[model samples]
Structure formats: C-alpha cells, structure tokens
Target: MVSGTSRAAGNLSAEVTNLVGRRGESAEVRRLLAASRLVTLTGPGGVGKTRLAIDVARRLQSSFHDGAWLTALAQLTEPDLLVPTLMSAIDNGAYESVRVEELTALIGDRQMLLVLDNCEHLLDACAALTAEVLRSCPYIRVLTTSLEPLQIDGESLYRVPPLSVTLSGRTFGAAVAGSDAVKLFMQRARAFNPDFSTTEDEERAIVDLCRRLDGLPLAIELAAAATRAMPVKVLAERARDALTLRSAGSRTAPSRHQTLRATMDYTYQLCSGKAGKLWACMSVFRSGVDIVGLEQVCVGDDLPLEDLWSTLAELVDKSIVNLNGSRYVMLEVIRRYGQERLTELGEEDVVRSKLRSYVEDIVDELHSGWFGPGQQAVLARVLTERASVRDVLSDYLRKSADLRSGLRVAANLWPLWISSGNPAEGRHWLDALLTASTEPTQERAAALWVDARLTLMEGDLTGALRLLDECESVASALGDLVSLARATTCRGGAYLYAGRVEDAMPFLKRGVKLERNLQDDNPHRAVGMGELAFALILRGDLEGAEQVLNEAKAFCARHGEQLLLSWVLVYQGLVALLDERVGDCVALVVDALDRKRAVDDPLGITYAIEILGWASFARGDARRAAALLSANEVRAERPGTHLMRDMPMVEWHASYVGQVRERLGARAFEAAWERGRRLTGADLFDYALAAKVPAVHDAPDLPLTPREREIAELVAVGKTNKEIASTLVIAHRTVDTHVENILTKLDFKSRTQIAALFGARARPET
Candidate 1:
C-alpha cells in the first residue's frame, strides 16, 4: 500500500479484468529491450503505456537472474525520495543502508530489470539516475514510461499507439471485432452490463463512438459504463453533440497524474465556465442522483435549474459523469474533486440545506409504511439508500446547533439500523443526539428509548438502564405511552441480560400489557411480546413461552417481517429444546437461519447456529456438537459476536466441550475442531444445519495447489510477481492469482507466510 510519504513496490495491482488489447505493442517493447540497455515508452495519458510495459516485463522476466521490479513514480512528488524508493524495491523487505554513491555496490553484477513508471514530471532526476545506473551496473536494464523521451544517450524511445478502431473495409463482421479498439469497447461494455450485445446498426454506432474517443482506453471505459442507462445508438447520438476529438501530441503534457485533485485542475481548465459551477454544486450527492435530485439541490442564483441539463451535457462530453439507469454518477475521483471545488465556491451549507429537506421527506415516507403490508418494500428501500441517509446525518445533522430535527430523523431510522445488523451504529448516532438535545420533549423521549433498546441489544446493561431511566421519566412527564412502553421493555431486557430472570418478569409483563392496550398492530408490540416470551422461557414456563411466541410469529407472518420473525423463532426453538423435542428445535433454528440470511443479519445467524450446537450436545452427539460450536466461533469473528458475552450460554461451551473431548479422545477431537474452523461460506451453514457435507481433498491438495506451490517457492526467494511469472513461463496476472489463492487456502495474510514455510526449499539457482 502507498502511504503518505512513499510507495511500496509489490506486484502491480493485478487487473481484475483481462488485458483488452496491446499484444503487438507488448512484443515490440521486448524486442527493443534486447538491443538497448535503457528504453522508454511514451504516450498520451489514458493511452495504456503502463499496462503494456507490465505485460512485456512479465513475458521477459525469466531471462533475468535477479528479478523484474516495477517502481511506480506516479505518486512521488519530491525528487529527493527517488533513491529511497528504488532501494526499497531493489532490496525488497531489507533495511540495509545504501547511499546513492554506492549504486554500483547495490547492483554488484546482478541481472535485474527496473521499470520506472510516470517519469514525465521528474525528467531531469530520471535522466540523471538512468545515466548513473547504466554506467555503474553492467548487467542491469532499465525501462521507463513517460509523456516524452528522456532525451539521453544509450536510450531508445517507443511511442505507444492507440487501439485500432477502423472497420478495415468490412461493414460488420468478425473483421470488425478484430479491431483492438472495438474489442476493448465491447469487453468493457459487457463488464458493466453482462447482457449488453449489439445488432449490426448498433455495432456501427459503437465503432463510431470508439472512433470519436480516439481509441483511448480510459475514455472508452467511461463511455462503456453508461450502457446500463441507454442503448449504444442512443449514447452514440448524444456523443456527437458533446465530444470533439482533439488529437494528442499537439499540447504539452500536464504535470500531475496520480492525484485526482491535481488532475482535476487540468481537467477543469478544459471545461466551460458553466460546467465548473454545476460540477461544484453536484458534489453534495455522494451517491448518484436523478435529474430531479440535481434540480432540487443545485438550483440556485448561481446555477439556474434549466441550465443543469446543458451544463451536465458538457460534463458528459468531457467524460466526467456517467449515466446509469435513472442516476447520473461521477467516478469517485471526480466526485472528490467536485467536493474541493464546492468548498472553494462557499456553498456547502446552502447546498446541504436542500439535501436535509430531501432526506427528511424520505424518512417520513419510510416511517409511515413500517407497520403495514408495505413494510417489506420500506425496508428494501431503506437498505438501498442507506448511504445517503448516513451522509445527511453525518454532514448536516451532527454539526447543527439545534439537534431536535436530527434526533427525529435518527429515531425514525432505527428499523434500518437494526434490520441491517448495525445496532451499535444506531446507538452511536442516538447517543450524540440525546446528549445535545437535553430537553424533555416528545422527540427526546422517543430517541431515549430507541437508544436504550439498541444499547441493551449490544449487551451494555448499565448504559441501557441509564438511558431508559431518563426515558421513563420524560415519557411520563409528556404522557407519551408509546415511549414509556418501549423504555419499560428495554429495562426488562437489560435485567434479563444481567441473568436476573425473576427481577425481569414484572416489568416485562407490564410492558406487554401497555403495548397491547395501545395497539396490537404496531411493530413495538411484537418487540415487547418477543422479550416477554424469552422471560417466560427462562422461568421454566415452557407452555406459556410457546403461546406468546406463536402470537408474535403469526403477526410476523402476516406483515412479512423477516427480521423480527427470525428472533421469535429463535426463542420458540429454545422452548422446543427444553421440551425434549430435539428434532423440532433443529428445524426451527434452521428456518430462522433462512430468514436471518435473507435480511443479511449475520449476528442473528450466529446465534441460531449456537442454538443448534446446543441441540446436538443435548442429544449426546458429542462430535456433531463440537463441530457446530467451533463453526459458530468462526462465523462470530465478522459480527464481533460471542455466545459467552450476550447470552446465558457461557457455561454450556465449557461443559459440552469437556464431554465431547472425553468421547472423541484428544487427537480426534482436535481434528474435528480444525475441520470446523476451516469451514466458511455456504459450507459452514450446511454443516450446522446437517446439510450435505462438501467434498474436499486432504494433504498437499488441501493446503496448496501445484501452481501455488511453485509460485510460493519463487516468492520465498524474494521474487516479485513479474519475476515469478518469467521464471514459470506464465503471465504476471497468473502468478498474482496463484499467490492470492495460496495465501487464502493456508489462511495467511501476507507473502511472509510463504517465506516462513518454503524459504528453505528454494532452488539453488534462484
């Protein structure tokens, strides 16, 4: 990872997609390197020079004895850090101090290839270093990427050309697809929309679009991603009105490449005056917005509402914004630049006020449908736009002087915060709101109980009690029964979490009665009923727990409430387990798991898995019990959930494990434990629910594949991806993929694990 001060040279970030074109350029670069010690690849920005160089290095790496290293200089600004950066990549994980004067000693006759990328800005420094390096290191070769030639002795320059986009005398056939530019455009368009395909007429439109973009890879990719919004012919028609292809090599290269802010300065210099203002105002939307959202926020004295269409068209012409379905999206780089421009224009507060109103309207619509048949739709919509809601709360609401409106918004959004398995996050927002708005109003009262409920769910018994005490008093003062009932239920749940079952009964009973009298249709009534059933189960009232759970479950079934229904079944499963109906208990938990998984509630899934583990232990299947419990621990790592922390099941783990160990013996029990830890994805759930076991290999096959082992051996000897690919006669991408799989199969995080295990087994020649 590149930090604030320096760049770490590792494998080039492996491209997730295939290399679209440039095969001929890759081969040509290799031939040039065989004749000259120093070669430079020059091209316009976004023309694919860096990718071509990486491909060439990967093919030629095996010939060199030392290694091939790509030192990206795109982010390096200060010329003084050049030597430190090269030394780090050359020495690779070593701290041996070597001065610039000792360049010959550092090289020492080793045959290595060095690829210095993005050298146009530091032309003088690059030339000075290249001259000194070629003179000192007799066996080393250097490759560089720049906007112009380095203009030095012993150097050959190769100017990379754009991808071919001509029809080649064919109207539309395989000959047309043979053009590198057409192939790249089709591949990138399908990557954005897998269903994208074209008729002959549409193919002509695509070829026209590529020709208009000058076959530049970056420009083509930006246009390709917009296929989801409109047809190719439609976009091509729009492109003619916006784009005017200016050939490269006419103007001098800009100084910045790596940082978007610096690149934005150059891009903004090219934009019209009206487009810049519209770009700045549009920055308030983190997620993409429709035309209506743009008009709602960006319409002001400086930017009229009607001007949005034309100014936005100019930006699209510049390939800054992409349209996806109903939304106009800016790439993250351009959006960050737009934010800086928004700050410069001094309209952040004015723009955010419009956003605040938009979110307020959205939340009000979301809350109104929470108890009816549209609840599922409401929850789905909440999940979809969760990012915008969070942005408004963070940017505008938190910094406001009066937090009453903020509190109202936050309190109403508790369903999303909980259904998304983010109760801890909900508590964070509510805690801030409660502290700021200390007045005892209806909004504060509701926010207090909401905070208390989330706090109790997170196992903070003391904190939940503190919030609920204030809530009870304020709700009583304001005569708000809804808030009072919610506080009472949370107080009971807090006591239950503390393992004081008898102390929880009276409060839970009163909460249920108050909720029922108020209205049985509210979601809070179901919440109270679920807690009251859990209290009944803990007190040995099995029959009573079943009756209460059935009622809540029926309510959930009618309203399509999967999240709360999952919880109701969890307690019902516990009641069945104590009733000695073991099969029923497992079936119930499995059903709950399906519902929890649907809502993406991982914590709820973990709890349900634990209940099945307990069911297995009670039936005397100690081996199955051990496996299920171990799998739960593995699943628990993501949600940061622990059976010992929130539930009264702490003693069960120790007691069940001892019995399991005695039955299976120490070694066999350890084998089972390791097997369970290795389970993940669908396999973990399958094993817990007694689904079919996934067939897997053992030994060398289980730990690493043959290709992975070969790569690991090369990696152990300090070879980077380019070196490994060259030595193994494979592509650099292939080597990176094998290394990633090796690490994942062995459960290792870094290549250091490869070095630790296979370092001694490296070949003598390497």
Candidate 2:
C-alpha cells in the first residue's frame, strides 16, 4: 500500500549511485517489493540508509514505469501534518475532491518506488501512514530510513550495517569500485587532496582509515576531508583523539559539504542571525538545551521573545539542530565549532556577560520566590534551563572577573543539584569557579563556602575540608558571618567524613550559631542548619538533631526557601535511619527527593538517593538497592569532591551489600560487587583526601605538579592537549605523559575529572 518512488520529485539520475559493492541488494529489494508495499531501512543515524535506498529504488525504477520518486522527510517536524505535506508534494489536487480512500486508490495501482529519507524522528507517523498507504495502494512501493523498524504490518525490515573495517590497501582499487565506503571516500578525497592519488603503498593506510571510521559513508567523507593537509597516516593519528575532526586533504567536493567544518558552517550560515547567535552561545552548554534555558540565555532584553521561535525554526530547517520533542540540541562537534564562530563575531564577551547576569538574576528570583504560589511553574522554568545554567557557570569559571556572581548562582543551585543527585557536576563547577576567579572579596569566600557545602552534600569530606581550609582566612578577615558559619558547617561535614565524629560537633554548632545571626534568613542559612542537624544525627544525638531539623524547617519556611526545607526533610530521614525507623526513613528520603527535584536541587537529590539506597539495603532489598546505586556509581565517575572522597561511603555501603551477597556464594552478587568497586574512584579518592589532610600526612596537597597544573588550567579552558604542548613548548608525548601523571596524581579517571578538579582548585579566594 506504500507509494512507489515514481511519484518522487527531482531528477532520479543525479540521486542514484551505480552498484559498487561486490554484491547487489537487488534480490533483497525484489523480495521486499513482493512481501510488502513499504520497506523501511533502519539503523544508527549517519549509516548509509539514504544511499542504499536510492540505489534500490533506481534499480527497481524500470518496474515502476512512472519513475522512482524521492520525497525527503528529513526536515519535517510535526508528524500529524505529514499527510497534507505528502499530498502537496505529489500535487494530488483533484484527488482531494474524492474520498480519502479513493484518492489513495488513484495511486494504489501505480508501479513506483517512494523513497523517504531520515524518517527516524517521525517514525510513528511514518509507520502509521505507511501502513495506511500500503493498505490503500496495491502495487506501489516505499523505501524509508530510520534508526529502528517502524513495526508496521506487511513491513520487511533490512538493517543497513556499517562498512567492514578489515579491508586492506590492495583492496582500495578494487574496493573503491567494489565497496560503497571506499567509493564514497575516493569521491570525497580525490576532490580535496591533490596528492590524494592513492598509490599502492598508500592503499593500506587509506583502508585502515576507513576501517577506523567503521566504514560509515558520512564518517568516511568527514575523514577524507582531513587528507588535504595530513597524510592518510597523520589523519588517522589525529582522528584517534577527536573522531569528529574532518580530513585535512581537500577535494573537488562542494564547499558546503567538503569538510565537517564546512558542512556545519553552511548550516550556520543558513540560520537567522539570532538563531546562529543562540546556537553558538549554546555551545557553551555541555549537554542538550531546552526552550526555557534558551529563552533565558539567548532571548535577553536585547533579543525579544517574539524572535525566538522563528530563529529556532531556521536552525531546524538548516539541520543545524535537531529538535527533540520540545527540547532542541546541537551535536557536540557542531556546538564546538559554533562556539569558535561566536568568539570570532566579537559577541562572545557580550554573550558571556549577559549569561552571567541572567543566571544571577534568575537564581536570586528562585531564592526569593521558591515557596510562592507560582513555585511549580518557576521550578519548571528553572528545570527547563538547567543545562544552560550550568553552561553559564562554566563560562564564568573561565572568563568572569567577579567570582561572586557564579558563587551566588552555585549556592542558589544547591537545591537543584540535590534534587537531581548531581552534586558531582554542580560541586565540580563550584570548585572550578572558586579556583578560576581572581577576585578578592566576600564573594570568593562565599564561593569557597558553596564549594565546601556542595562537597558536603556529596559526602566528600576531603574536598569539603580543602575548600573550608581556603575559606577560613577569608571569612575571618571579612567578618562575613554566613561564610564563617557555612565554612564551620562544611568543616564539620568533612570531619564527619574522616570519621572524626566528636571533632565535627563544635563546627556544626558554630555553623548553627552563625546561620542564626545571618540577617537574610536565606535558604543557605537553612542548609547550614540542616547540615548541623545531619551532623548531630550522625553523632547519635537524635533529640538535638530533631531540634536542628525543626529550626531549619522554620528558617526555610520563614525565608521562602522551600528547596532548603526539603534538605531538612532529608535530614529527618537520616534521623529516622539512626532511630532504626527504616521505613519512615525511606518515606522521608523519597519525599525529599521529589521536593528536591521540584525546586531543582541536585545535591539534595543525590543525598536522598544515597539515603534511599542505604535504607533499601537495611531493609534487605539488595536488588533495589543495587539498581538505585548503579545510577550513583555512574555519577561517581564524574569529577567532584563527593565522588572523590566523601559521599562514596554511600556507594561503599551499597558495595558492602553486594560483597555480602558474594560472600554468601552468589556469583551475581560477586559480579555486581566487582562492578560497584570498579565504579569507585581510587586515585581521585587519594587526591581529594590529600588536599584535605594537612601536609604532615604526606597526602600530596596538590595532585598535579606545577607543570601539570599549568596543563590542567589550559585544558579547563578547552585547549587541546596538542595546543597545550605547543603553548608550553613541550613535546606532544611529553605533554601526554604529564597529563597521565596528573590524572594519576589526582586519582582522576579521565580528562573530564581533571577538568572538574582543576575548575575547583584553579581559583582560591584571594
């Protein structure tokens, strides 16, 4: 019932590629034609489904004398509107006058191939409509590409696999003509690299390059572009580090598609100014972007909200971004390139300034407005722009003059982090801002205080101690009660981590006194009270802890700090756990988790999850505990004080359950324990502890040497290792060795971990 390609617009000849593989899919296509009117090619995005579909339709075009027609669905967004779009594409004017059944009947008997490209996004509509068309059409044929099968009736699915990477150099000549990947590569390379003439000797490396790219055509084309300035070998070498790097070699390929950069450049050029600007600024964000975040960051006072939708649409049309449901995202490579362009446009500084202001203003609002009637909507808006918020923090660490803005933002965002169980990322950014900023003020002290609290939230006593140690002098010098109070609370939290339970008491009590004296009665003060209660509970002072929780709750309610109130709820859970009221603990923790999310508190979320896991383990539900702990394990892999030292005790608690199961002779339990152990940081743990413990313990206060620190600082700002080596006048491998040493010294698992630590340690409150 699917429509055939004969209804396809545009020339079929230019679209079709001759059979270049050793075998043909003709038999498969003929079988698909016999079994189902619609055939969907489903696989990973960027696999050669489009080319394969075109070739299939071209071969079968003779059977459908009307001609093979291709109507691409790549740019379409709304699936519900597909029917009208399709009808218009085929220009079925008079057919509209007839019944829908009759209109489909008109084309049912026609023999043609209908090729639909990039139907993954609209898979549901594509499937339903294709099923209907197949039911209506008797002789028509359809071929489509998607990431997965549409699961439609009468649909025969053939997965298009990536090209084999095993082919040798001798196979290049034969392979260029015989392999679709080689042919695609040659087509792109011959146009770029004038010296791209593949000698017999060059054949092996070229094939190796293709293999390394997984033989995917798009990947090959991107790799081929790199050949312009690089030998095939060198191209492969650099590519090992950054797979997205386009070939250095130039070919006769169109400027728009010649290189990955060019393709992205073309996409950028097609966007409206605002869209381009937003897209480029979005590069500052590490993950996907949402509309709320976009509005806050991109649609400032200068850019009106009226222009936002149109700009987004333009970006969608140019394929500069993929609109996911309501949220939109740019690919990592594209985002990086866009960031470069944003800087070049001389608007980077302005954008950064605006972003910092937006964060400060919004966070201030969140602080005051959290418990208001519009709290729900406000929280949703905050959630929507959470990624962008993080991006702003990232920018501030690298460029902002006053660290106060970022520090305030970080302090305000604690609730969000707690709710999301992302203390690691939040704390990492907090640490980075504290280290990266060059300011000398209470703001820096506040940043250090926030950093300490974030680390405490993650249970990273060592990291907390490090930040607290730095803040001690600053708080004392400024006579900043909040900073001093928070620092004391943080120091207590760190002492708690090191199992110095009695030593932690005075600090927590001092923090409580300080919070009481603070004039604003903000959520941060509430947080300090909550931590005091938590410390009390940890020390088995249940009654005192309960008193502290009540105080925190009253403070939060009084200050409209609903988010901080939730952490007090989490503290209540901890109190229940201490009282052996495990079920009550579970309930309280779950409520805290929900409330944390409602207010966008990631640190609270992580704490809640950890408590939940701990309680679940106490309840003898190892399976559920393991499931919950798995998420925490993955989170721990990210750099942060909590992951490195403190909160890992929660993970260690879960690990104990798994270990217990293993000791009882359960293979599954052993496997799970091994996995959990693997998840915990070994060296980062050492580094975090080293930073906190005094030099008397010989813990290596600074994980990286001065040289490593210099390298790490550059890396935090997005410089490549090669760039770092060149800038530092060191050999590339020597730089590599230094990085490895840095990672080892700091107990970091990856560059991201180092970046997180560097971000934290780079700036100290002057």
Candidate 3:
C-alpha cells in the first residue's frame, strides 16, 4: 500500500509525477530498512538519492502505525536547531524549549520511519540526535540522505548510482524506450511538449545526450525541459551550454531541485568560510585541476595557501567537488553555479584576470622550453589547457576595449596556433583584438605581423602582404625595432610564397641584419635566419644558403627553438638533394620530421614530409614520394590557416606532383596517394618514422616553485613588494628575497626587465 498526504501524514510532498527510475535501488533500500535502524542514502549531488529516499518512505508508510515522517534538514543552518526541527516535524504541539532528552522521551514508543533529508551539513548534530532516537524508541527507523555516510554504529549505507542508460542489441527506438535515463527525459520532455515524439534520429541524439550528461536524473530532466523549443539534436549539440539553463522544472518540486543551478546552489550554501571562496575561485579552471595549479592561481584575497587543501577536502565531503586521483573536478552544472556565485560576489573580473595571467606565464615558459628534450611535455601541457586558454583569450578580446594583454597573448601563442592546428582560432582572436585596438602601440604592431602570418597560411598572399605593410608602417612610426624585424621577415616570406623570390631578398636580408644585432635571443631571429637560408637556396646561392642555415641552427640550439630548427633542416635537406647527396638528404629531412613530431608541430611536420617526398623523388623512388606528398596534402585540408609558406617547398611540391603522376601512371599513383591521405597524423608519423611514439612525461627544470612563480607573476603585474607581501600574507623582506631570486634565476638585471618580459607597466600610487 502507498500514501501521499503532504504535511498532514509526513513531510514528504505528493509526487506530481512518478519517479521514473531507481526501482532496484528503492527495493534495496526497503530491504535495508527492515534490518537496520538507520539506513542512509549517500551519493553526489543530483544523483537522485533524495528522490529515491522519499519514494522508499512513501512505499513503506503503511507498515508504520505512527506513519512515516520527514524533517528536511537542508533549510536548517545551525547544528543547534536539529533537535527542535525534528520535534516540530514529529508534532507541532511540542514546545520549542524541549531539549534532546525531552524530545527523545516524547517520541518514546512511536513506530515510524523518520526521513532525514540532507544531513551532510549538520553531521555531528544529526548523528547524535539519530543515535538517541533509535536507542529510545527502538521502533523508529531512520532513512537519511547525505553525500557521505554518518559512520555511526548500526548505520546501513546504500549508495545511489545514476540511472542506467547503457543499451545493447537494440535499435535506437527500442533503446530509448528501454533506458531509464531516456524514459525520464521523454517524460519531462512531454510535460513541456505533449506532442513530442522520438523519431529514429532524435532517439539516437537523445541517447547520446543522456550519456554525455552522465545520466544524472536532474541534468537529463533539465535538458529534456529545453526540448519544448529545441530539437533533441540541437539540445545534444549544445549540451555544454545547457548548464546555464534555468527554472523549467515543476514548481511543486523542492526549490533546490527545480533547476540545475538551484540544485547546485543548495549545495554551495552548505559550504562556509574558505570552502565557499575556494569553490568560487576554482570556477576559473574549465576542467580537472591539480593541487599545484590551484595553489598557483587561487592563493590570494583571504584564501591563504595553508588552508587550501583542507577547504578542498571540505567541499569534497559536501559533494560540491569530486576527487579524480590527484586531480579535482567539478561537474559542469556545479561549475556554472559557482561561476554565478563568483559574479554575485564581484570577484569574476579578478579571477578572470588571474587566469589570464597564469596562462600567459605558462605560454612564456613553454616558449622558452620549446627546443629541449621536454618539448613533448610542453606540447602536452598546452594541449591539456587549450580550452581554458582559448576561453581566456576570447573573453579578453571580445569584451575589453583595451586590447593590450589580448594582443600580446595572441602574438605569443603563434607557434602554439600552428603546432596545435588552431591557426583559424588564433586569427579570429587577432583580428578581433586589432579591430578593437585603435592605438598603434608595439603590441598592435606585433599582432598585425601574426595576423599576416596566419593570412598567408590560408593561401591569401595579397591580403597577407597588405597586413604586413600596415604592420611595417606602425613599427616604423614607433621605431620599435623588434616589431619592425618581425614585420619585415613575415613580409619577405609572403612575397616568396607569391613566387617573387627576387622581390623577397631585400626584405629578408634587411630583417636578418637587424635581428643579428638584437641583444635578446628571440625566436624571430631564428625565423629570419631560416627564411633567408631558404631564399638563398631558391636563388642558387648554395654556399650562402649553407652559411645562413648553419647560423640559424646555432641560434635555435641556443634558444631551444625546435620549430625553427626543423625549418633550417628542411633548407639543408634541399641543398643536399641538389648536390646529389640523396642519402644524406633523406637522413637530414627524416631527422627533421622526428623533431617536428616531438613538438607536435603540424605545419613544420607537413613541410618536412613534403621535403622528404622531394628527396625520395630525387632518388628515383616515385611511389614513396607520391605517398609522402599525399600525406602533406591531407594535412592542408584541416580546419586552419596553413603555415607552410615556403616558396621553394611549394614550387618543388607542385613540380613533383606532375613527375610522380607521369612516372607511376595516374591510376596507380592516385591509388597509393589515396591510401596515404586516409592515414591520421599519428598514424602517418608512425608509418614514416617506423617507431611508436612514447608518452610524454613530466619535465624537470621548472624555473620556479609554484608559490615562487605565483609571487613573481604578481610582481610582473606591477604589484609592489609590500602589496605582494600583503596579498600573499608574506613579509615584505620575503617578497624582496623572492624578487631578488627571480631576477637571479631568470638572469635579469632589473625589475624593469622582468616587467618588460611579461608586458606589465608599473602603476603610480594614488
């Protein structure tokens, strides 16, 4: 038998709709209650534990003569109120002055099931009161829901798993109809749209949507409610965006569970002090974050580093955060909820700025380490945080009129954009920033040069040359030697790509000469030197090309410039091929291909493969040459601006295509080329190198400790030593020591140089 009388019989509200899943879980809870005095339903937030507990209590109410009663503990903030709240729920006539002993005696012989919802916040109070009630009454069974077990004696814990969505050996329609996740989705979806029907395609999309949402009941329901206006396919495509969806649930439901954000907001309200601050600050990370990253980015403004781990643990106990091995993660809905709270507290801008600064530091370190044995590690780290980096750059570019940091960050990540096959995204950010920035500062000048490079990669030679002219004009007006050198080099490369080798020589020569005198070992110098070598080889100046190539190689070796080194090797390989050292050419280009692969540099690898194909053709291996050329062409079709702008390589590839076609006949060569085109980037490298790539490991020689780096970053952003000391809670002398250590470690002579390196200017005191 079942009953639903709302507050009259118990605190359990009448179900507006039947609970759609958890039949097995409900039965197990019933069985556990028969033998145990206390049965707790424990799981993460939004996993249906509360709903399942309510369902179980409703089903077994007839067996208890005093009836099943519920005392919702989520609303009670103080632990001291636990006994009074329970006494009121059991009987309104009970006096407010009744203590725990009096309440226990008052409930002495009642045969009832007490449903305690959300006991995680008041664990000690709840545990003490529960133990006293069970000992005194003996007939009252307690059913509680919490994120963690009470760990009291005689407590039976039943963890509620999410609804099952895994379907096998069934058609799409059959799977949707059978799945508990899909059934709940369809039920809620129909509430908003009665005429809704799951067609074959929509069924498949819904199944994937449920799986992507982790089959959490509330998330599925929230997504289904969105189907009132959008198709299932559209909902699936925008699931990540659905985290922001609000208030589409039944009004009768608990205010917390009525919306996804409210559900998380309830959990957030349970956290106090440092827990709340940590929760808000962690929203800056888009994915899993380790303790080291949290310490680096979240250690300021009332959240000291000493309290971070304990606060994180507190949040984990409340189920607001999850622990995945060494890393911590928040569910998407929870992250959005915290983000909303962060905005409410007016810390959104501060956190966003800190996040941007952290990413900038990461990019700077990666740039410095690009040519070392740890190149692969650097690539992996950047790829891991690529989404967050993109979000930071996009936010700064689109929302801010002051394009200082946005432009510089975009310019600094040029190699990343090329290596990660995201030049199109890079170009989008650069273009937006340039449009917003009216001042012709050196930052804008540098942005224009990067913009032109991406433009040239997309086969837009004229547009690229026009942007370069603009860059050169800005640089000349400001007399920014660094910007001028970059612009000149990019302009010369653009002309070369347009098949004007002679027209490119003067710019290349001038840029190389200017870079040679610069004090810093900038990567642009390696770029200029490499391009000059390529142009010399195109003009039949072999000795000049060899000397330039050697210079570029030495410079890259000093600066750890792996990408530029690969370019130099390509030119050397071409020179060797022309001198009839086919074996040496093959060996050099193959080694260059390996180096490019180490850095995961797609553009450099493409150029190397094309050169290797040309070398193979020179050795009379048309089949091998055709296959390699086809692989390069496949990469060119990816969703980005191509960075292979070398005119000599381009012209050679065009000529080789015809030679391979005539030599192997169209049909056979086309067949082999198609085979190569189907290979993925990793698979192509495996085939070319004939070796399995090892997993990237951690790199030693991190320049500073996480805390020291955090302090240095604060210093770079123009914080005075005293201000830094106050923010991080260190002494003024400690800040001075850290700053002095930073200068010594980075080989900088003054704080001004550190500021210049990180693109920060000191602010005047008020």
| Global lDDT scores for all candidate models | 0.74, 0.64, 0.77
TM-score of each: 0.58, 0.54, 0.71
lDDT of 2 by residue, 389-493 (tens): 877777766655556677778877754555555567777777677667746578778778766766676565666777788888888888777678778877876
lDDT of 1 by residue, 1-766 (tens): 1113222333444556777778878888888999899999875556677878887776666667665788888768777777777887776654345567666578778777889997876778888988888888888889999766677998998877678886665546876778888888799788777888888888888888887666766556656766777788887876542222222221323344332244557567656778888778777777777787787778778777777888887766455666778788765446667887888878777778888887777788777777666766777766656667788778635576647888888899877766666787888788877777688999999999888877776677888899899999999999999999988888887787677878888899898888888865678878888888988988899999999999999997887677778889888998998899887887788789877776667667877878877786676555556677787777666533535555555555667778778877887678667866876766666556551111121123446767777787787678999998888899999888898897777655566546534532431101
Instruction: Output the number of the lDDT-best candidate.
Output: 3
* Between candidates 1 and 3, the TM-score winner: 3
* Candidate order by decreasing lDDT: 3, 1, 2
At residue 420, give the lDDT of candidate 3: 76
Clashes (backbone N, CA, C under 3 Å), per candidate, total: 0, 63, 0
lDDT of model number 3? 0.77
Name the weakest run of 10 consecutive residues (lDDT summed) in model 2.
688-697
**Model 1 spans with C-alpha error above 4 angstroms:** 1-252, 255-262, 269-275, 290-314, 323-327, 344-346, 370-377, 396-398, 637-642, 691-766
Candidate 2: give its CA RMSD in angstroms.
Answer: 18.6
lDDT of 2 at 606: 53
**Best candidate, TM-score:** 3
